[model samples]
Target: MSNLIQPGETLRVLVFGAHPDDCDVSMGGTVLRYVQAGARVQFVSLTNGNKGHQSILPVALAKRRQDEAEAAAAIFGVEKYTILSHEDCELTADLATRRQVTTLIRAFAPHLVFSPRLCDYHPDHRATAQLIQDASYIVNVPHWCQNAPIRGVTPVIYFVRDSFRYPRELRPDVLVPIDEQLDILLTALCCHESQFFEWLPHDKGIREVPDADHPEERKAFIRKYWLDVRKQYDRNRFFSCLQERFGEAAKAIGHVDAFELSEYGNQPTEEDMEFLFPFPVYRRETWKTTGQRS
Candidate 1:
């Protein structure tokens, strides 16, 4: 792991998730592309997922989750990983937890931070999002955490997609094409053995994908699972966004994942967008609601 404050170099990104697999499931492709583009990416999990399954022992489950997370990180080429060791299903937006996130923001000084949106059924997910959102804004405030150094600039915050939202207000402002990296995403997700085969079961009970000695059977199993998930997402929207950004080539693509711009600190300018994201094309909604001029 390369740990040094270089004078002028790569962009740093910090991804915070409520559970071990959240980051990988949502932003794994984007993370991989960032790392491949020579940026430093660090993933942090607020909870170790010990209480995720009742049948398994907590200690053993935690250990398995940690190992799986490490393996997934390795797949993404992420250098740094931090697990908060908090009990699963018990996260809160308390001062101490906020400070823990603040400490990391200070340490990494990431240019971009990805977290869950504040609209969710899970308490831990909502709490994690709130904590990260608060820490992102307050990290630069010297009075909040005096010991930690202030961030140079306020980082851009992004919200990951959720399975369901009650109010259904969250909207995507960014859609990154993951067609090339879907295989990697699947492999990374499959690392979490407990979540896939152990805990994930429909109303008809757990449907096990046959993993036989034959490579064809395994590939078919993976393809079926991946295709079903791909069908659930609004590929058309993502493809449109991608086409806007990447032109005709993007239009030819099939599937992609979306991300909503939950919070844009200080309102990034056009130049800033070019410097930070560098996507070729995009459309910005007029800031009419907030009475903020574009």
Candidate 2:
């Protein structure tokens, strides 16, 4: 089905992540752009993020993570942030999980859905991908998820790029430049204090949290920490994608997010790409001759 959004339409987006901060880390900038353009977005964490902290107990950690997620959502003006009760580090692509995802899809009726790439280091990330893939078509099936109304068309699904490498590589179908939204993205990410300051640093064998009790000092450290991480993992490829699309001017873009189309959802055309991304498309000569937005 060609479920392409038209120009000037208010789009609906649903993003699924394995844990609380995953969505913000991967596509927070893109979500910011969408919201600025008046799109409605729902960020859903498939797991409770109970296991994220190195020291906090599961119950307390889960509540803390949920509160963090809510705070982050408020930063983006996203009203519908959902965290499923599934235990952290234990997500599975089982029948029940698929049904739950399908139910959410039908209830939201989003025009586009985003999830982690199938090739991921974390099992929960992999499982979340499988659940999204399994639910893509099922959401459109009449008999599935009886409590929710079946959507007439399946949402277009895209997978966020992961840092891990595999024997068979995954390539991005779209690169969304996020330079303008970098500060906002970092602010949203900072809300996930448990992950950024505690869990990730412990996982990486480094002390990420600063000793300073001042809020600005802490924010500065988190911003720099993530910027360094992004530079190490994604900066080069993101620039390459931008250069390929918009030529030399892309070098000015310092940050970006990448996404790959999934086979399980709506097949988008070139026109669909224009509608969905709405970024300034530039040809080398066009930018060189006339400094105008394409």
Candidate 3:
């Protein structure tokens, strides 16, 4: 086995977000926790978030968001912040986009890959998820694309949590707590002031929070809204599952982000699971607590 799989090896991960703030919102805490545990993490935004703000020019907003992302990455000790320069709100899971993602996947060659689910309300999120799924196998196919170097080994893939419930499609087999990394996540989140303070609610069809009336309360409301999206909706069960797998170390925490182990990529072994998921997991006995199993 490689030294990276050793007891104290630095776990590496690659996170893909459709927008500038997607990773921060969806898996920020997990990112923070990974860093805290001596993991090397990187962020990739499929788009520059040029269309993220109002009362600002597109070019200017993109640059601002990029700067903010860099600052946030610094806060989390992220090694790199890669922007694909794709236009926001118009992202498509085309061949070109998939190829770009493949290159990053090969270049990073992370043990784990995290990205949005295919069922999100946002088109960009859905597109990115599809792109990731497609590229999951493409990265390992030597002859798939001759131009770029192929990553022969397929890394384990996982999907980020979505708050919304859409009838009968649920695939999450694991949850990782972010409570330990909440502070770092928040610090990174604050970098996207434009979206969190201005645009996310507005774009989500939520009424805008006016600055004149209880600005702090409005900020609190927005924060809570995101927290609900990120934390509630089976997050607790996820933590419980982590507790089962990782024991007390992964438990004894609050706030969890969920993910569905992807069936499209390489199937990780027990050892891989031990490395990639260093959290307590749900046992048959504990399964009753959540009325579920992993």
Q: Pick the candidate with the highest lDDT.
A: 2
Best by TM-score: 2
Please rank every candidate by TM-score, starting with the best.
2, 1, 3
Decoy 3 TM-score against native: 0.82
How many clashes does each candidate structure show, in the order listed?
Answer: 0, 0, 12
The full ranking of all candidates by lDDT, starting with the best, is 2, 3, 1
Q: Which residue runs does candidate 3 get wrong by more than 4 Å?
A: 1-9, 201-222, 236-253, 279-294
User: Candidate 1's residue-wise lDDT over 1-294, tens digit each?
Assistant: 112233475678788898898787767877877776788899999988888774889999999999989998998999877899889999989999999999988888877788888888778888999998778667888888888888575676777766465778546565666667767766776776677546653322647655435445444454465443642364563455666667878655655556666544434444444444543334344232322225
What C-alpha lDDT do the candidate models reach, one value each? 0.70, 0.77, 0.74
Q: Model 1: C-alpha RMSD to truth?
A: 4.5
Worst 10 residues of 2 by lDDT: 284-293
**What would the per-residue lDDT of candidate 3 be over residues 171-210, giving only the tens digit for each residue?**
5566665666665566567667778767776677777554
Residue 111 of model 2, lDDT score: 83
User: Which parts of model 2 are misplaced by more than 4 Å?
Assistant: 6-9, 231-233, 281-294
TM-score of each: 0.84, 0.88, 0.82
List model 2 lDDT by residue over 1-294, tens digit each. Answer: 235665466678899999988888788888898888778999999999999888999999999999999999999878688999999999999999898898888888888899987888899999999999888767777777788887574677888867666754556567777778877777787788888778888987876466437566666676677764663356575556667777878777766677777767876665565566666632122112321112
- For lDDT, candidate 2 versus 3, the one ahead is 2
